[model samples]
Target: MTLHCLPSTDITELPATVSNSTENPETQTTAPAEKSAWKTLSGLLPFMAPYRGRVILAGSALLVAAAATLTIPTAFRFLIDRGFSLPANVATDASASATAMADSGIAAGQVNSVFLGLFAVALILALATALRYYCVSWLGDRITADLRQAVYSQVLRQDPVFFETLRTGEVQSRLSSDTTLIQSLIGSSISLGLRNSLLFVGALGLMIWTSPHLASIIVGLLVLVVVPIMVFGRRVRKLSKDSQDKLADTGALANETLNAMSTVQSYVRENMESDRYSQATNAAFDSAIRRNRNRSYLTALAITLIFGIIVFVLWLGAQAVIDGRMSPGLLTQFMLYAALVAGSTGALAEVLGDVQRAAGATERLLELLHAQPAIASGKQSLVASSTADVAGLGARVDFNNVNFSYPSRPGEQALEELSFTIEPGQTVALVGPSGAGKTTVLQLLLRFYDPRSGSISLDNSAIDSLKLNELREAIGFVSQDSVVFSDDVYANLRYGKPDATDEEVRQAASDAQALDFIERLPDGFNTYLGEKGVRLSGGQRQRLSIARALLKNPPLLLLDEATSALDAESERKVQMALERAMSGRTTLVIAHRLATIVNADRILVMDEGRIIESGNHQELLAGNGLYAKLASMQFNAAEFHPAVEAVRVANSPC
Candidate 1:
């Protein structure tokens, strides 16, 4: 059975100070601190500004629809009073019986005409409502697309430090779920609020006109519904935002675990991880339930209080009808208006809560967009010439009194006052135990982070003085992990030199000894490599990494434990390919296997972030220092690998 254990989590040092004063000026950039999102709604101005014309058109249609809805009550009033029922005085007049038949016929015709008029009003309402929906929905979709693009664009520019705090999955959650909430507020809630506000105002006006005494009672009771909703809606918004945060945590966990499924399953922590995810989801559910409960109370209050008040007022209107104080038609018309006012009031209560939730969501997305990278552009005049010209132009590298610690492991220096130099076309090896800071040296040269003190230079020019891309362009790297994306071989190789032609890519593969296996695959160079290149052997994967770097053909090459994971046979082949890759390049090898780098032009033995010994294979072996001890312990007589004739070295005892 394969053994699996959790990697070390214990930190031997505290985090680096937030101050940038000690950081090397050439690579240092500053980002503002995270601020609270109190003005988040105002942050959406740019995305909303582009759709102003559509917003205006949508508003106009909403108003027209509300007007049509309000007109329906007037049509009903005429049908009740003139078309169906005549005034009592008219029926009781002297010539009433003879004129009654004529009046009845006229009323019948008027009733049909009024029904047709109501139908026309409904048609207008439908058309206006549809147009309003189309316009607002389009605007919402367009705005969300632009907002996602803007957030991702900013996120892509951030340096490693930014990712150290926040995760990719959390960003994805805000991009999707948070933006979706904003879309709902824009497309549905805002339009509903405006239309219902107009309906409430117009209907209330007519209710007071028809019966001021009744309207006064209803208005006073509605204040009860409005006040509680205002109080409870604020709580609901807060609860909803908390729920979203908890859900985002669950998403982040899932994303992290899923990407490392091999590790998770290999260790059999499936249930443990599942339980953790369950706990997170349950917490989210609890928060959502609290928010939903508040909304439920608000809904119950609005509907019950307003409708109960309407029923009581309708009872008064019935009494007035029986007392001959008002006509049946007027009482009916008053009830309709009262109902319209109640419905509008109920809608406003719900819309308020939606507005609050959208506000919180908008704050989150705006926070993402506001994040600035710590690697902002530094002006420079340096340019990398063609790869051919760059060989002799500027391949020399130097480290001057450099000291560094990872931001996360601040007190433990990965490198301390380490100074070294490499001439063009020299092969140097860095051999040491694990955690001896071999990889850290390569990281510094790429300018992923700046040294805490001192400086690094390339070709006698400060590296930080050149643009980051320009500096990186001069070097090619192949690490032990050999990252292989889920893509075709052609695309993977082209990642090194994006515009390289097919012939160039194939030639690079041939140089790395990857062409034989690649061509043997079903689709040859077009074959799809599974995620992390699981379809290929370790040697094949390493060679592909070498091929990618070879395609770049930079003047400097870095091979960090490049063949450490392969079998003896695979190692021999990859080592050969690496030798071919190192031709005419300044090569730096960080390796654990003693045999791999024994023939280097020079070898440096690092321990505790400082070099204890440096020399060629024969000199180091004869010097009898840490290098000699490690070499004696690791091999019988470490001249070279016996599979193929090893490179001629300064001294070979064998």
Candidate 2:
């Protein structure tokens, strides 16, 4: 017997039609919204709000550091004039002493205190600057961790539909790369930007106080620099977003190819995948280069204009000093302030570029946070009637005139107005051709998606009203495709019933006929199942899945072609195990082979989402309907014909 591995669901495709006329067209658009840099920057405020105290403290530290830095340039003025110049009394005394002791070659003290004062100022500034750096760096790390945790928690709470539109690599990128950018902005750029901005303003203030004419020259030069930055800032933001997009595309391509390495190797398409990835990388590189070129040009232009103005203004100041209109010391202080302003402005230009790039990253992050999920939790929480009540476990599932079209395939209905009932403690087999709503039934039953215009209920309560987690807890499902995590056999088996004890787990595994094989392994139950249980054969994986369901012991067991992947011997053992487990529970089986479910209490043969035949196997075969046709095609006549004929003959009227 050949067992076919189940195919995974792909959710990237778009729907051809809209189920609701009011559905938003924007949801279908591939492009993100156009936003300004300022708008994007402002969006980060909410995430930062919770850490306002840290921000305030960091900003205060930066302000102190800036104030201290501004004082250094002014201290040079006092050092040059008062520190170098001798006191009148001392100078007179020294001249008289020098004349008196001229023959003896004696010297007198002419000490200046300005150097001592300047040294004190420098020491204070250095200490305050060091403290500010430490504080801001600490705050940066703290805020980044908080933001990352917040994003991760939000992603975890989101419904599967939210993930349908997102790729794992893209999400990982935002959490890592994007958050890192925000951290740099918060920790370093914000502090440096505020400090430099204050320095620039303070130096300008002092320059104007010292020499109004030179201050005017500096302001005019800054205005010229600002014009170009304003013009190119928006373009830089757009390019930054493009670069991030291309990079994410490259990451996603690599992730996809690696995840499907087996398929790539089987098809021998390694070179093709490599070429595709290289193309994405090249696009990212091109965008990054363009952004870098624009930044370089902006920097060079700002520097040239700023220094040219400084040079012209300094020449004017030098002539004033020569004509005795300004003291040499005062001119020195004024020139220092001008240089400070020029340096700060240059730093500001670079800060502005970083701000624009961070804005782009912030916009991408906010888009993810704001996007709504297709499914949402109900306002009211559902409570189980009683924790120990077995009656509460037995749900009366009814598909009341249900119709469903996949969200990604709206024009074509996957299920029509299909109606059926699974009575408590009855085993019902659903037999159908492919695309005949077999899997759709299981999806609906599991509440992955609500019907387009019908209601599904459990024990007279609409499933919609019940808490999703509460509703799901009462049902156990074993699909054709079982997901095995990279965990030990014991942990994987207990996944369905996390609280089950080791003894309980063993019992469940034994009931599923998986104990013998599990024991023979080197570590037995402790053996780790390498990714998706690729270490195990198809039959072993199926048995382990059965063990999981058995451990769950849910009142309603959903077996979606559970035996389809088992060989003849494994099939017999699993079928017997299932029969034993389903003795006192409600069972819904999506059957592929006719023999396995021949003894089901009731069988519903479906075609194109509608139930066309319903009865026991013998009864349905006697009626010569859809069930009979499917059974004839799947079952061997010679193997069971004589037995079936004898039963029919015994029941016939002679």
Candidate 3:
């Protein structure tokens, strides 16, 4: 997937705009506009597109169920009017026919036929209802699974900068909790809502057919009920959004603390962290309580209003029956239809609440799916000029008049006109004070971020013009903080070179002095390293990282304070391995210890952002420059001075 760069400014502003409301001080606010509910519902049609067949089947089943449900009241009407008490004229004829037919033995077959028909109707209704439940349930499961997968895939495709803008916990909450809510709406709520809607309409039609006078009263009451629902619907949506936000905040808090448990323990701030997490959880719990209260109130109000009107109308029908204006059977049927309509209205209200919540979740997801990356891919591919040309195959990096500032701190430039060169097959050591843009230079080389004003190139090709994956694949890196996964030693080493053979991995481990430790482990190469390799010593982890780099075997090697964490003995062993790895490769080493890079082909002393001095160890020492001063402060001149001098002599023309 090719990602176009979005302005960093725009990417930073998205979270602010995606939120629900600004009025509440507790929640982030987004711009508000009144859009149609149906329009919002229709937006989700894309997610449902793949499961159209299932939806159609479910819809058909629901229709069948609704039809059967609607017909049930009619059957009650038949049983009451015919089986219990027939009409005046029919009653007289039935009595005469029963007596005359009984004499001829004919009425028995007629009664049996009527009972058989009723039994068949009941059986059909039961079977249809069962089928409806099965089909709708299946549809819900299938559609929700598809939706979850789609959302997950979209999240995975996003660039690293996109993740930086949103909390990992928040994203995870949306995937699990938020998606589950939407799934409930899709799988059950929606089906029930539609079925109830059909029941409401069918019952209303039947009521009018049975007695239009009473139907008018029912319609008038429904209009009153709708007014309150519409008014409260907006509030329900806003609160639901608030509740979700608070829950996400709680999740973010917990996730952050758990990921950094070691740091929390080291600082002895466990109680402090726990208190903060508890506060977040309490806030979420409070919001949830308020949300549930509001929903319950809405439901209670709806049911009370609907049933109150229904009971009043039923009382009027009973009075009509007493006046002999309507049959008892007809009145019973009307009451049943009225109950159906009233029940459906209550269900519909609940569905409205769910739809509103799902809409909020959908909007949140859409905001992420539409988010853009900070870095754009270049138009042209970066190709090596030729295999024979060493400089052409590897990069001759020249940071010419470079100036940069972190996007987060636009006010301060981290690097200013930092010009330097790392020739092909030449190891250049960058020595600098803290915050001297050493790491920033490495970031630029990896194209994690572009310089504010300068060009970086590989061979003669601009770095930006190269495909990002291709550019990164050509460079091997070993940082001070090496990441180790909770996997076997062999798997961790092979992470750098997935296709590397077993022998190649063993050879790299041997070179890094990690093989001796691995052999001592219970399972040798298969020993599982605990999370972040906590079981291994800092030096052992560093050696594993070195082994990883050796396995990758990229043409250009970057060692960013790689040996800073190792003890003297481990450092010596790893340094030897590094020297072997750097041979025949373009190497850039960032070091604070002056002794490690004294044998480098060139050394660049950096302060703040610019290069302060550049020369070999002896030349810089002879000149008594910043490099010499740094060397004097960091290394034992009496012991390491001869080694520096020897390197200078060997390189000084034959």
Candidate 4:
């Protein structure tokens, strides 16, 4: 019912939760060796603090229930002693017993009053029990909801790097299974623990009052039972945590493989995945069995010791009654309370087991709650009224002596001393072989990763000074693999511009050349796109992405091989739409298809993270640099239009 992925530690019989943290190198957390497992639950206090009224109400109802349970023994004592005590000499025949009762002068009204009192106690116990359950269950549901929302909100705000170290499925397990354990603890376990604790203490007090000598002996003997339970308590808690970790492992594996079901099926790896999951599941079962066994042993020891002591105490009380040192009614009352104590003490052992299990669950959830994202938005975020009011208003983008390396591959520079400027309304294309750092340039501009040693500015001010949202507002980005959600066509198109009207949506799709295909669907624009747009062709998804960008209509546009996956015909149509939309906008294009950027205002060719050539199509050709080599590979000298244009433009120049 609830959700997020969490990291793991290995236990003796459980599959370890495996993940890579996606946190920025700066905000990564490390747990100290001395940190206790119980400390993890301390984070839950804040979530519960808001509902103190409900918690207090639940606690009060629990106490009342326990008290009502305790009073029942006294009522039973009254009823047995006065209301229905058999005459000592007349039990052999029914008529003789009735005559004996008549001769004993029994009070009819007294019998009714005692019966009524017992009924009142029973009624109070039932009502109190119901109220307690209702209140505690409600709290469990409420806190679980609040907890899920809080954890998810935190996770959503984390940087992508955080997920790089964690799996979504692992978090999913924590959210659903781990939180379910917490709910059980609050709704059933903790309430049971408290009520039983009250009964145990109350019954013990009454037992001492009835027979101090017997109560003292039992109390001393119970220390033996308590010691072993405490010893196994740590082990049980460890196993509980391990069981959860192993379950998370299975969830993560299933999520990972199932999401890539096509790839797995193609490779005929279904059996392999199934076996892996089975192994993980069996390992989890092993841990759970171990935990359950230990808890059972604990419960057995406590109940056996408690009942054994009570049985011995009952014999002593019988002896006292025979000697006339105690009345039969008093001995019966003591026995009832003794049984109550034994039962509640037995329950206390199991409640402690539940606490141990919940502690593990709490520790797991807390790990996520305590994690701080490396890239958090600053409080002084820029407020942009429109795209034009953003920090880099018209998108005169500048990268000044930028040097950077990805955190994952710190040894190799992703970009090195790269400086370039794209003037407003200039269509600049970055042409390079793979690993030329063309994509890195786009990432830096979008602030996906910050440059290590350079200042990036939009318009005139530094980009870091502006809010991430504000900086992103001025740019329309379309990547190679366009993401399409499982939603209607119109919804996907309006993702970038949520406020876009139906007319605006139609115009943007029309501009991106996607309107034709969309209109042909049975439901037209309302047709659903399946997961990752499985219902649509690659070209269609690309066009939808372009439509989304067009809807934004920002001053700056980024095209990262946006047409690379389309067929020739699809590419031609999408390219025409892109050209139409790119006009009058400052566009930075990353293209491997050399022909796409031949007519750009300028093309900067790069290699080894630094620009090697910068010029128009003809200017770079004359230089015979890296740009010319790339051009030659894509276009033959005999028919290359850029080469022809170069000569024509060259000869006509003054």
Better of 1 and 3 by lDDT: 1
* Residue range 306-327, candidate 3, lDDT tens digits: 8899899999999999999998
Please give, for residues 208-259, the per-residue lDDT of candidate 2 as tens digits.
Answer: 9988987887787778767876777667666666677667777767877999
Please, what is the TM-score per model?
Answer: 0.84, 0.85, 0.85, 0.87
Instruction: List candidate 1 segments past 4 Å from native.
Output: 1-39, 89-111, 201-224, 308-334, 384-394, 636-654
Residue 421's lDDT in candidate 1 = 89
The TM-score obtained by model 3 is 0.85
Error of 3 at 322 (Å): 3.1
Candidate 1 lDDT over 97-200, as tens digits, reads 43763656654566677888888887888888888888988887888789889988987877777777677777777787787777777777677777778888
Question: lDDT of each prediction vs. the true structure?
Answer: 0.76, 0.74, 0.74, 0.76
Clash numbers, per candidate:
0, 0, 1, 13
Tens digit of per-residue lDDT, candidate 4, span 473-536 = 7779999989899999889989979999999999999998889999999899999989899999
Candidate with best lDDT? 4
In lDDT terms, how accurate is model 4? Answer: 0.76
What TM value does model 2 have? 0.85
